[model samples]
Target: MTATHHTTVELAKLARVLDRDPGDLAFLATLPPEALREFRDQITDLTARREARRMQRVGAAAKIVPAPIAAKIAEAAFGPVLAAAIAGSVDPARAVAIASALSPVFLADATLTLDPRRAVELIAQVPAPMAAAVARELISRGDYLTMGNLAGSVPDSVLRAALPHASDLDILQVGYYLEETSAADRLLTVVTDRVPGVIRATHNAGEWPKAITLLGLLGPTERSKLANVVAAQDDEVIDGLLTAVEEADAWDTLLPVAAGMNPQSLQRLAQRPAMQNPTLLTKVADLALTQNLWLSLLPLATHLSPTQLHTVAARVATEPDASLTTLIEQAHTENHWPTLLPVALALSTPDRKRLASLPVMHRPEFLTAAIKATATHNLWPAALPLLNNLPTTTHDTLATTINTLTDTEFQAAVQAAVQAAVQAAPAADCTATLIQILLRQDFAPRSRSLTLINEAGNLETLVGTITTRDLALWEGLSDIRTEIPGHLRNLLAAQATRCGRPELADNLTAT
Candidate 1:
């Protein structure tokens, strides 16, 4: 569970003990959930002990009275609070008989004051029908805390009968007050088919926080089931879910469910119109960076439109370097390159360069994974620009991986770079980075690779890059001069001369 929702649940339980509104103790939200629970337990213990002797006296008297008469006197004279106080002390068989004879209304009244720990045996022995009756009374009165307490003690058979009487909203309200995840899971297990209706009702009632809190209490299979149901809802429901998270800043509560969703369901959620909202996208991005939710958010990000991807990328660009480093390491650790590469591609050039300069980017394993993912994802256009910005210290590491690519992978990179150059202005940095890697490889493969580049009509772009940046590229090319066709070599000489590199022109001509 998220800290925000956990703290809210603790506060609600504490508020019930004090008979105050949860909002009345809003200041308690500043305390950790453990402290809140400990304090509430201590107070409950004190309250239970305060009337111990008096309640024991009532119990002793009730043992002698017939069940029906005791039920009447307990309701009419003892009242609900006193009746509940003496319930735990009564003999289990007599207590069950007395409870069965009382009106559900009176029982419902007593239930609110009954501590489940003290009356567990009596609660378990109550007939299923009577328990359901009391549950219905609590539901009608909107006393979900009492209903939740009863739910914790009742048999699964009783809950199965009782829960259908409550509306979807009633279930969520009751779930919010449930002190045990096991109880909430048991309650939800009995009504698994109702989950869709419950989610729809949550949106209609604007109770997303409560719905999300209920989601946190479910076991994994049920949690994923609920998350998928939410993902499959119509646009309005999806919008409400986002609105609630944004309002409460509760992305932590929602993200784990999202991370667990199947790809199609995740894609459905990613395509929601509300997800494209820039402010919401930025908030989610910031939270993901700070909380290490990239494992969850990145897959969803891959399904976003290009415009939304850019919005998320811009937010990511503004985060601190340490956070950015963690993002890269997480992506590497999870093998989430297919998910993360597009967002990285969406960053502006300067931001992309900043990302490429992170120390993690220099690791051989990271660069190798990146190169492999770039080919697998057909992301050469984006990858080339970022690769151009990698620190020179890492170039040999990148080249080692580049040199080991299979014939198909190596040719794919060459063809992709050539295709990129043809479709846009000459990418000088891309050509130079490829040349630098080629220069590091053995002659036979480098010659074959250069032959493919020449056949792809990329000699002009290559020569242009060599002339403008490093005349030494001409010297590197001279070693494989025989691999260069006569016409392309003439083109290289003319460009080198045109760019005022007479010595490079001579070197190309000499070979």
Candidate 2:
């Protein structure tokens, strides 16, 4: 693997003519300097002569047959075999001119005898109608190998008219081996009406790999049609398809279909055991993130295990903020709380913070769902900080909600709030805010004691501040008189008086 050096002049000509890297000419690497020069000269001469002979053959064919009589003379003397040879040698434009006058049926027969490579060049010269006829003729004979060769080069109108005449199985086989995928994709639109039959034929043929490959080439609507066909089959059939795709390592081909499945269909797919593989699930998650398919994927993700859900959450957490927010909004709008919460819970702290800040969180329904989710998942420790970070208005709203909760739910909320407060520690702004809001209302006894006795300082400071802003907060201060300390009582009295609530200040001082 030692490197060799060459002057710029040595490789410039050979590189341009051969279109190859001079370094790949490994045989040249060990040769003496004199041999390199001789070898380069021989290669250049050979290329020049080969190109000259090809042109000379075209020129000779042009002179041998006048355009008007070419078809007649070709058929009479050369027959289909020799006529194809003559057709293959002439320039394409001249071949096209002569082909226009020949019978479509005759050209179709002659094409059968032409070399496939030459057939590719000349097929493009024939009119769409004639090519259609040829395709029909070829398909009738089950000559799919020839049909497959022409698949990439055939005109749309030709394939459109001829494709219907072929059986579903033949189209599947031919379409699979098409030299150009784009051409096959275009042809698929023509066979759109036959997709259900074609899918069945492909499935029965046990050519699941080809079925998946063709499925990959379809547009969303067409792919959906094929997917419906897949969805209509029995579980055993569907499982077989999944197993085939797995064994073929064709997840890359199958994932886009999975990504676009309707919820019911996706639910079916998610229930399949093959989808439980961590490796496959991780790859699917990667597709979800890269493809902005989280909304579609989220419903299906609900069917995965906690361990699998964590993989999805970890991958999606790395997506752009707008995508994450959109995913959350779509989830809430669709009432997908069960799916959304686990993912949100699994998010990293920074990503969770980002999720908390989304404007969607300000909506009442979304906020309540998030709170309920905390209790349902027992994620109080994680959920508490997120709720605490909301706008102060949201804090006020949540305080009102606590009294409305069922006794059991209220207790869970209280326990979560306590844990959040403990975890938040020295900077328990959210805890302080929640306690103040709850204490301002008629909450259950346990919540009252925890807020008033254990966190009395937070409640007192919050009351003084709220009372200063609005004399209304003074409305409920006497309810916790035993819990407020002497200095805080004096602070509240002066604050209440400054807010034009002298009578309230008198009550506070007496307490």
Candidate 3:
């Protein structure tokens, strides 16, 4: 489309708003006089004002976003008022309504433009109710981020139209939400639209987890796209790319992305060693787990903490019919505990106790750093709970290894812990750990009282701990021995069995 008479003036205003170099704008604006008039007419089309208001409404609804995101919206609008429009305080419904009206105008006229980044930022900011409008607008534009971001809200018809036009990278992006939003039907539909080959190209900027998830949901046709994208990247994106591949073992194609994961995830990914035959996936999961990237997996991979890993280690594996201990044993051959231990301890329950039980020499700086960090950040409670979980062997050792505090000093620390414990809704694990210690170190307890078990939030572990011990010591407990002991014995044994120690379990003979 040729520029109309006012092309220079409009171009200058747009350039100023877009914050482009003035010379660049003048150069882009330079057109034949006749062409300039035509372009000006196009720019002033009623469609232009209509579209501007529509984008303006989107900018208006984007007020909820933090300023940085709002700024991105501004940049993406191709000089439209993303920020200023969003801040106007117009009712949200009105803004979306106006924005939808102009979407088709901007979409149909190539000369009538909208920024993909700005459009996405705007779409991402729209309220959930108006999501369809945002999705519809995004579909008309047909950018990768737009197609992807609009996935959840777009109508199936628009989505279908977008599928064929989509490149592999676009499929990965949009497909990510399909997989994550748990829209499996959409995910499968996308797979059908995909051209074969998993293309591993650099996705346009934005967090990539959802896209990675989408990659996992792909069937054969889409995988061809994944292959293509994989062929396009430097190694860093390999983790993301590999993460997607790690989901299913149908290696009808070479697994290129598997090279980038951390040791732990890689280790998990490598269980089907035959498909990802490089013999290096576990090594990468381990390295990644130790590095800061390990934390990223908590939100994206799984929220497994060390303590959680420890307590449910058996169950976690069992539930899935996979044995975690076996994997740990196998992983030990190639992986280092330093990376896995610290993160698990920090985030998982089983790992926390496991670390707390570790001999000092066996522990690494990372473990110490995590513990010291809890202390330094006034997060003593996080560490204090682990103290309860410490095995008897480790409890005795930690006491000695801890600074040579006298009885008085130790009492003071316990008092502090007691206060902290009281503030917390007590836990069964904490009670069980303390009970284990109590059983090992019998006495009229001082600061670390047996009654503290009652205070801990978990009743099952409390009942389990009390039942396993001879309850004869507590007051008024002797008469019920025949009645309680049998029941308690049977219950404790049953609980233990559920906890995965059948041999240790009591053979409940109907009490």
The whole-model lDDT of each prediction reads 0.80, 0.63, 0.40
**What is the per-residue lDDT of model 1 for residues 344-442, given as tens digits with 9 covering 90 to 100?**
878988998899888888888999999998777776766787777887788778777876667677667766666666676334357777877777767
What's the lDDT for residue 502 in model 1? 75
**What lDDT does candidate 1 reach at residue 250?**
76
| Model 3 lDDT tens row, 1-511 | 1122124334543443355554676765656544643453454455345666774666555656554454444446633343333323334354344444344334223212333223444434454434434344554565333344346544455455545544555555455433123343455555553433323333334334444444444444544444444444544454554544344321212232333334444444433322243333333334333332332222212223333333322322222213333333333433333233333334355545554444542233333443334434344444555566554556444433333333343333344454544454333235344334334332334223333432334334335433334322222222222333344445555665666655445333323
Question: Residue 46: error of model 3 in Å?
Answer: 25
Q: Candidate 3, residue 138: CA error in Å?
A: 7.5
Candidate 1 CA-lDDT value: 0.80
For candidate 1, what is the TM-score?
A: 0.79
Order of models, best lDDT first: 1, 2, 3
Per-residue CA lDDT of model 2 for 1-511, tens digit only, reads 0012222223432443355776666555555534555665676556445655654564476666677687776666657655665665677778877777677667666765454454566666677666777778787777664576567676676677677668989888777645444656676777877876776777788877767766665666666656766876778768878888777666555666665667677768877777777787777788666655655566677666667777777787777877766777877777666667667656666777777777788778787876666556565544555665666667555665554555556555555554444554312445444545656554454355444433343434343333344344455565655555566567667766777878887876663
Return the TM-score for candidate 2, rounded to 2 decimals: 0.50
